[model samples]
Target: MRKTPARTRSTSRSRAAVVAVAIAAIGGTTLVGSPASAAPSGDTTQFKGVNWADPRDNYADDPVVLSGLSTSDTYAQTYAKASRVISAFRANLGANTVRLPINPYTVNGPYWKSYRGVIDAATAHGFKVIVSYWEGTGARKDGFIDDPATYWPMWNTVVKAYKGNSRVYFEPMNEPHGYTDTEWADLAVKWLGTYPSVPRNRVFVSGAGYNDHVTSVCADPRLKGTYLSLHHYGFWKEYATYDQWVSDLKERIGNCASRTVADEFGAPMTTGLDYNKATPDNNSINFIQADTDTFRQLKMGSVYWPGLRTDDTYSLQKLIGNAARPWLATTNQSGADRLAWSWGRGKPVSP
Candidate 1:
């Protein structure tokens, strides 16, 4: 999983009359007492440029409340759980986006048959799938995958499942955060499987340092076809010293790839609820707070970490993008990279 966003402090709100007019004109909805302002309506179009998993409703702040997770509890049950996850967020059911982090075990293990089932359900719903996976979470898994060389096979299989579907965007890994250029060389370019008309170009891989995709690893020629990803949080102010924090966190990527997105970023569960109590007035006003705007402009697309946790994470979601939170229209698709989705009616649920 990627790091989440930080929470913002909010004290007041505009009059009910103002909210009414904004909602009516913009098809508006917002999180209460959050930075009160305009919101894009349900008619707010979904992700524009790339298609990946971002069903805010899935376990966060979506319209349709999602259910079932026993299958995802363990690798043995991954196929079963993955099936339910995809089924729960079907596209035709009004779920246009999904966050399917590919489970290599379930995809290549004995339960592999069930992995295909998830893809079938995705096609049924018309979702623009984002297939991401988490590997050993280490520098590299040097051993050859003899038991399950499912990498190429999975790609070919998933692409074929959609019947030449263009909505699917394959993300190779979750956080290749600390990897060297050579580490990604194999997955990015040299693979053993055949294409079978599948588009390897659609497969995206994370860059270095968690989700700092553009700054660290997007330069490899082998990674020519894929996009980059980034992650940040509004709470950075609470931890690091401003002198060391602001400059390091503000890694500028003047434009490296065809597309780059803030895969995750938001406040913590603790701060969101008592944000006013925790974040100092001075800290809140620091440059760390500039992330939202800087990211919105630099990445061109952003998806805040979910405020809605498996339990009640609204404390955190409120600072990100939640209809219940009432922040600006700077979510799944409201701002840029062209992929973020907005809170809307009939949207699926997060948890």
Candidate 2:
């Protein structure tokens, strides 16, 4: 999807607030901007995290879009550019966790009506928010073909207009192709039994195409679940080698299922622009150091891409907002989703 507002928000919000004030001006820290960032009242174990990008789509004007306008009369400029990309992605994600896919033609409700105010500022940014409904066609809205029981009446109207109480999560479709592996285990056991009390670990599913060589669609056994949410961009180029994409995503889901999370991979954009501070030379920083060494070998939870502005340079915080250069953190901020806990790199203490 592509958005516009004088071309993707005044040219990608002046180049993503200058890469969100240059990531607190090059990691000196203490740089916070707000208009939002307050929704995680607590517990979903604080949604560990993933979705740097890939079906984690839309950037270049930022999320909550109405992109490339097809006129219903540019639906109020695509609902004011999806309410300013979900209030600048829930104001730089104070806590963390985001993921948002759902509309492969989601029963065509106007692409969830301009993606409902960026899914209501991503559950107000306390993100446990996964809401992946995974595309429509429950056999023409409900007789069932591969996956779609009209997503339980469109998640009862998108989990009651994003008030889905408990911080929300559901990765129903993605990487999903035609279907097989028993029709992806009968549309995830008929949409995980249409939310039989939501907590089978609040819904999670991943694997279809980059689903690390298909380890049997969310490892069915009639769909006993917890979390597997996987997808791999196979080291985004450089001819593979980030330990062979984390040793083939840990032998494709640790020997056929259970405990996965990798979620997604790089988007490719940061080519040369560390704004002179130097040293992030560019060309996908070797796929951002192979996604920071596969998020420290799957301590998991990551999210990247041209979150808002990009030319080309394997965006993982645009080389940390261009090495936090000259003060700022907006290569695209709303806390670039809190530097994804720098992917467990000797940070201890807590995520």
lDDT of 1 by residue, 1-351 (tens): 332222332212112323233223322222121121222122112432222222222212111112232233333343344444443333212335554545444455544454454454554556555666544322232111211344456555555655377766666556543334344444434331233243544455565545544654556544544556655544443545334334544563435523455555544333323221223343432322344434433434444344223332322221223322222222222112111222223221121
Local distance difference test, candidate 2:
0.42
Q: How big is the positional error of residue 102 in model 2, measured in Å on the Cα after superposition?
A: 6.2
TM-score: model 1 vs. ground truth: 0.53
Task: Return the TM-score for each candidate structure.
Answer: 0.53, 0.29
lDDT of each: 0.39, 0.42
lDDT of model 2, residue 201: 57
Best-matching candidate per TM-score = 1
Q: Candidate 1 — which residues are off by over 4 angstroms?
A: 1-67, 72-96, 109-126, 136-156, 191-196, 234-254, 269-289, 307-309, 312-351
Poorly placed runs, candidate 2 (over 4 Å): 1-63, 66-154, 158-191, 195-220, 224-228, 231-241, 255-263, 273-351
Worst window of 10 by summed lDDT in candidate 2: 5-14
* Model 1 C-alpha lDDT versus the unseen true structure: 0.39
